[model samples]
Target: MHVESALRTQPRAAEGERVETAERVDAVERAGLARSVEHTMAATSTVLQDFLDGRVRAAAARSDVAARLWADLADGVGGKLMRPRLAVAAYLGIRGGHGDDDSAAIAPVAAAIEVLHTAMLVHDDLLDHDEVRRGRPNVAGATRARLVGRGLKERTLADQVQAAGLLAGDLAIASAFALVASAPADPAALLRVVRLLAEGIETTVVGELLDVTGALSSPRDVDALAVAELKTAAYSGSMPLVVGAVLAGADDAQVARLGAVGSALGVAFQLADDDLGVFGDPAVTGKSVLSDLREGKRTELLRRAYAMADDAGCALLDAHVGRADLDEEGAAAVRRVLVASGALDAVRELTRATGLRARELAVDGVPEPLGGYLVGVVDDLVGRGH
Candidate 1:
């Protein structure tokens, strides 16, 4: 899902050795991909700005709140743009290679994916009571900050801010559909894109429901994997790839193959993220390493750890896993138990196997240049250090 990392240039061949034509071609494609990512970001900004401007003009009396909300949503746009990049990559891959005309044609679709991502993140943050994302204050956090500045008490401030965050998420979801619906593509393709987007959204909602239920009740590995597939895999990975391929008129077989590839890669990405949430460096990941353990997120990692642990280890887990006041010492204890139980290794192996499957699918289904790029994406996402 870290699309930017995948697009980075690898080291050049030894100075004395000549580069092959394939390598040179790959270089060009990589540059095009980087530029396309930038293009998508800019186009997304334009779409958001135009929409916000229209809203402001239509209701001058509410313009202040509207503008503030727009700013909050806009601040959320500068992520890695993974979903949008996936859409563009799929389109270009299916179309043979990058073309300016094609890139222009797919820009709206790419922008819509990013808009939808923003909406999901806003809602996710509200659900998690998380105040930050990508190293910045999230919509809910910013709303709370603004209200606090106006001298509202804590309870009232939290209520108002949460409501505002909900509305912001709703706006983003509505705008995402509008962008895709209005994209200037073939009428049939546009309809397919809309349907795909709706399916992705619905699946994610179901996944969220499962996640909440699992967290409150029993957290099983099977249930966790299901959540990953429906929540992160469908929306973050498969939808963008499938949507892009659909736009390019890919055949059903090809579309299905790419969806499988995307789902595998997405599940791998989430599993790796679960590892990082507990073990990655805070400075590098831009989030607290203890957050997941403190919250007892019931990820596959935790479930595995619990399953593998002895009675004493289980006792330790029970003592501190979900403690709201879980400090560094408590987290360290849980970490020790997790490592001793070999759960981390199990999760890592699962991620590696899943990533390998995704690579296989990409190599078999997608053509060269694009296939290689997607393979690299899976590699970067699965093996990322942070």
Candidate 2:
């Protein structure tokens, strides 16, 4: 699902010349995306830092609550601000406005996205029973740490930690809604954005439930890929882009186009991510080796592999898939079976098709500078490891 592989089956400019031309095009797109993300991150960081600082200071008298929220915001905001920044960048691209006030207006909204994302992480960790995140303790892990520090007994500690993490996640979700409502934009647009964000979250939650339920049930008829699109793609990709378009005063057509692009790209991104999760280098992905395999979570790739497998292949997978006791060699063997079953190639083809649709959906009446920049953003996201 890497960028190169994602476009493998698509029409090319020409076999020999296409490589040279594509390389140049890809390089420019990558640079533009990097620049845009860099600028957006700078602005987002300032807003997030300021917001957290204010929150901490306001809660100064309430040390316990303030400290918990502060830790959540600080840790959550520091990671890539890609989602909210996408909204702001899209706004700027469409409106061609960059005044100080305009820039300031986006911070809270962007910060809201971070808040929402962190809340989702808190929930996701709870669902997956993950022990680590962003190379550190997640909300659940952090709560457990606090409980241990308090010298709570084992069962008491576990219950308290779980409860605290769940509540913290709920607070983060609430804060995100509050931040969006507080954005200094057109009141109507702010309300619309808030509503859309809530709907997107709900949609994603439904998809997540389906995914977890499917994993525990029979594998047949499970469209895990579609679930990935609905859950991860809808919120992570579409919502941010749509929010940006709304902020920019984009017409209905433009906003809809951005959403379509977001949806397609989001799916591609998630598929690639799933691939990397199991097969990627730990050094590069910043997670434990074969974490996804060890976790026994069902991904589109896994479902497809299982479906496409021969009798012997199915036997091999049945013996290994979702076995927490699997060793390193066992995981590698499963991967080999997946590749041999041609599931990887099929999924890769779907990724390419979706990416092309995304490119088509992305083309709209946006200003040239902004449009080019946005396209670059799409390219970099679908093409790179990050």
Candidate 3:
């Protein structure tokens, strides 16, 4: 029922990694994906999660401290697995295989992406001084809370919490790389996949450093949008898509186009997260509205607001935003400036623009059902609050 040509990559693919080619394509296709996209993502998520759980438990068994630390770290693991889902879609789309087809080859990389995402989030929370994530106590937060309950105070509490977060994040990163390396792919393809991970980490590290040192301090410095792309879009967005397509034996042009599609989506996703940080209800977003304002996160929204605001609006932002003692009243005042200055709406428009761009690119870059599917992915991504 499938065209032989559909199973072959362009001539350029032969110059790179060896394509699975037509002889084996039908066998691979028949081996899995007898279902649909939903089944594919669900199966992929299951595989990676099992890997994460098994590896984590094995490591935790090594010591009491390891067990306690990982228990706290595990609390951060459950999420939408958006990264893994995207990777699975790209793989199936390129390979012309469906859920349950050729899954053994894709599972490790998919799981690796999710593990890496958890690692980045853990480190990001520590850097941001966040005490909660996904409606519960995070690694640093849960540990710090327990310590406080036991009467641990001041520098001692800070010291212990930081150590726990750092170690846990390190373990996840190590495991992610290891998992991907173990994927059953060509040596060349596997190397490329591993390189993507390393590059993502490199880009994210700079992004985090810029954010911590105050990205908005100088007009010459990197803007918040740039920071968001580097920090989030690189690893969380493009890299997942790239890894999936690469394993599926896509050509260079296809790879680049898919990367572009993912970058656009990733940027949109980050911008939406920026909006949620200020405006969304904590009950739904599971994150504090006050943290972004109190931390004075240099989001594009905040930048636009400062640029468009009246002197009075500027004065209010300067006073309450970034104040450690900032309460609900101060936060409300800051939110007012964000609204009155029209920056909130502007950022929302930017998010929409990015999503639209991704939709267009998806049509041009990806194949039939896959392109349509990614367009739907874009729609949901931009519309999300959490």
Clashing pairs in 3: 32-100, 32-101, 33-98, 33-99, 33-100, 33-101
Q: List the residue pairs that clash in candidate 1.
A: none
Candidate models: Cα lDDT each: 0.83, 0.75, 0.81
In candidate 2, position 280 carries an lDDT of 69
Q: For model 1, what is the alpha-carbon lDDT of residue 325?
A: 94
Higher TM-score: candidate 1 or 3? 1
Q: Across residues 1-386, which tens digit of lDDT does each residue of candidate 3 receive?
A: 25656556545577454445643553444334334555766666777667766766886779767877877876688688889878888888888865355677788788888888989989998887776888788899988877887776698999998998899899889888888887878889889888988998999998888788773483224388888888888887788888899988899988898899989999999899889888887788776788888777888888888888899998888888788888998888988998999988888999999999999999877875667778878989889864
Q: Which residue segments of model 3 deviate by more than 4 Å?
A: 1-35, 149-153, 215-222
Clashes of 3: 6
Best-performing candidate as measured by TM-score:
1
Go through the candidates in order and give the clash count of each: 0, 0, 6
Better of 1 and 2 by lDDT: 1
**Candidate 3 weakest ten by summed lDDT:** 26-35
Q: What is the lDDT of residue 22 in candidate 2?
A: 69
Please give the RMSD to the true structure for each candidate, in Å: 8.3, 8.0, 8.9
For candidate 3, the per-residue lDDT at 31 reads 38
